[model samples]
Target: MLLSSFVRKGLLFFLLTCLSIHISKAQFLLNDSISYQPKKLTTLGISAGAVYGVSMFALNEAWYKENKREEFHFFNDAAEWKQVDKAGHFYTAFYLSALSAQSINQCGVKAKKSALLGSLAGFVLISSIEIFDGYSEAYGASVSDLIANAGGSVFYWWQQNHWQELRLQPKFSFHRTPFAPLRPAVLGENIPTEILKDYNGQTYWLSADMDKFMRFPKWLNLAVGYGAHSMLYARDATNTANGYDPYRQYYLSVDFDLTAIETDSKFVRGLIKALSVIKLPAPALEMSKKGVKFHPLYF
Candidate 1:
């Protein structure tokens, strides 16, 4: 499992590296960085990276740990294996690349053009990456991923259309546990805050297409509904716990799996779900020995 995971992660990293090169081609070079804003696409790109990063760490805390795991398992492994790793990867890459492109275009650098232009740019960029990946040995072309890529775009677009509380679930839960309440960790938005951001204030997570995209039919998929949220940290800055900040940098990650299938597969799905169930649990994950700190593939 370690070897396979390494192979997979290596391939993902390589593709992302190549993707950065592709982005450079699009903008010629990055113009400037932007702050994390709602759906500025650009911030969303980081959100996506944060999602990938946190999920990977939470799922498999010590990837290349002590010896080598016979398997690198996590409930939220990704839509890849279920759909065929190749195409699954392609779709994910395409969506994320599109995400980057959208962010680039979303940057104020563009003119009176609509936000959709940025999305289009993102879509095209992701497409190009797919072509590049198709040429590799470790990876190959995938029609399913292409469809999913297009689907994510279309879904987001559709959200712009009606946005009825009727068409979709008013609000969906992004993260849940057998431990506590079932809901997105809110401090301000839909739900009111009873106790400031610290203990009482509650907020609702925005449900979007990306939320559904991440989940499977069998497992529950959580989403970092917040466009950008600081990972949980301790307010005490002066006396760092034992010289090391106990504050774990916990980035939000979406969960992807299927409730439907899990209901049917019972045994198999239960096992996978159990693995994904515990991770970065409000602890200083960033500082945790299990934390994974890696820059995203930013073009």
Candidate 2:
């Protein structure tokens, strides 16, 4: 089994907090002449090492202790959730790496160096999780997941290198679904838990800035999104027995770039930067196995 949703969120929050603090300190303490000082870099390295060690220990206790196996191996999960999980892996890796690179740049690191370090940090973090999975009996390392992870990191790096800005952003949105109550054990028991576990409610999106391609409003973008529904099991037999038909969802929508809004306040800029990962509420045209549907004010 994977780490509990709470634990995973906590881990990510902790890392982001640490990185933010470090960046703030670097801005306050370092002068242009002494930026990238050896002492600061050493401290950063030690702090990151400590954080990674603690995270690994906590994850092992929470997720791997009961599921570990004698032999390390791989498991094929390419078909699970109609590849929704794979898209998730790619999305997570891309955003984390991009954010890390931005944070590093804020700390007075050169853009190229920051990008390299950030990409490596993202790849290592997710790859470590895959290594843990390799030893688990219930779930093993997945090649497809690794590929997705790399793809995300590479995409982030390539975009930064070429454009110095992300014209195409990966985003996420979620809405509560009635289906979660039908299989609470496999999905989740509450909104918070279900948001993390239920693939049916979550949508992954690639929002492309129209201004990048042609004349258009700077804040507006065209988004293509993917989601899944009725996926209580990886295989169809169990779902059929339970009177559910699993299906994939595709969507087209409009999104906004909060960062594009003029903001002189540092805090507001930071908030906008963080919120950019989320797809804002808008009307969406959805296509699924059953047919077509429209969502007004979709999250």
Candidate 3:
């Protein structure tokens, strides 16, 4: 339950940040390296701070105002949603850190410095949301969530420092699931809500850039994915009581590395970069406790 709420809010937070970044990207050469400029750094810092302040304020007013406040507390939800929500935290954090690093890098900061600061920025931004949860009567902060968030930032930082490129990229995909109708209040009543709240429909993938290591097609990636279904409730026991047998799903699929596609137009390149976060529909082999199934075009 807490995971669903957090994921919804996190998605909104990420979208807001991406909007700010898209606007910034248009005004500056995102890839061009300029000489170290202190004024640009200061401006970037101010801009980021402003965005953070405004977004946090908005969240407090719009999302937290209605929830009853309570003393700070810790929640244990490690068993919820089959740990699919944890993967979401990792995915969101990685992209947030990556985006932050990219933004700072464009401001004339060195790669290592930018990455370090950006990773920290991502961690702080996401972790701060837990404060609201900690004080809410409806939701208490989860230690597992904090750990997932940290793991994501650290993973991004390590990759930036070592490979200097994403060899294994985290990507997401979703499809409408019948399970959402079973419990609309929990799973979601509509497509938009279902996309964020329905764990059954969501797949998190680790797409390995095959060409990065060996002789493979540059644009082709091999992806391993995780998902779950038949979950009308967050807990397996509760779900089973409701006559829904929830089970974890694993997938093997092929993905496209849009970054590998050569494009002369900056707009096209930027579009590709932005779209890279989505795992495109492809033939996939799904493995679960029930049995293995194949989808010709799985989303």
lDDT per residue for candidate 1 within 179-249, as digits (tens), equals 11222342212322212221111112222234334544333333332111222222234224325232222
User: lDDT per prediction?
Assistant: 0.33, 0.75, 0.80
The sequence of per-residue lDDT tens digits that candidate 3 reaches over residues 57-85 is 87778778888998999889999999998
lDDT (Cα, tens digit) per residue for candidate 2, span 1-299: 33343455456556656655544221111123336656656666687779888888988887778774767889887777778777877887786676567556655677777777788787776667777778877778889988998998888888777776678889989888887798787667898777777788889999998998899998899999999888777666778798888888999999996766776777776677667778999999999878999998888
TM-score top scorer: 3
Clashing pairs in 3: none
Report how far residue 119 has shifted in candidate 3, in Å: 0.9
Lowest summed lDDT across 10 adjacent residues in model 1 is found at 164-173
Cand. 1 TM to true fold: 0.28
Q: Candidate 1 or 2, higher TM-score?
A: 2
> Top lDDT: which candidate number?
3
Q: Indicate the residue-level lDDT of 40 in model 2.
A: 59
1 against 2, candidate with superior lDDT: 2
> How does residue 39 of candidate 1 score in lDDT?
53
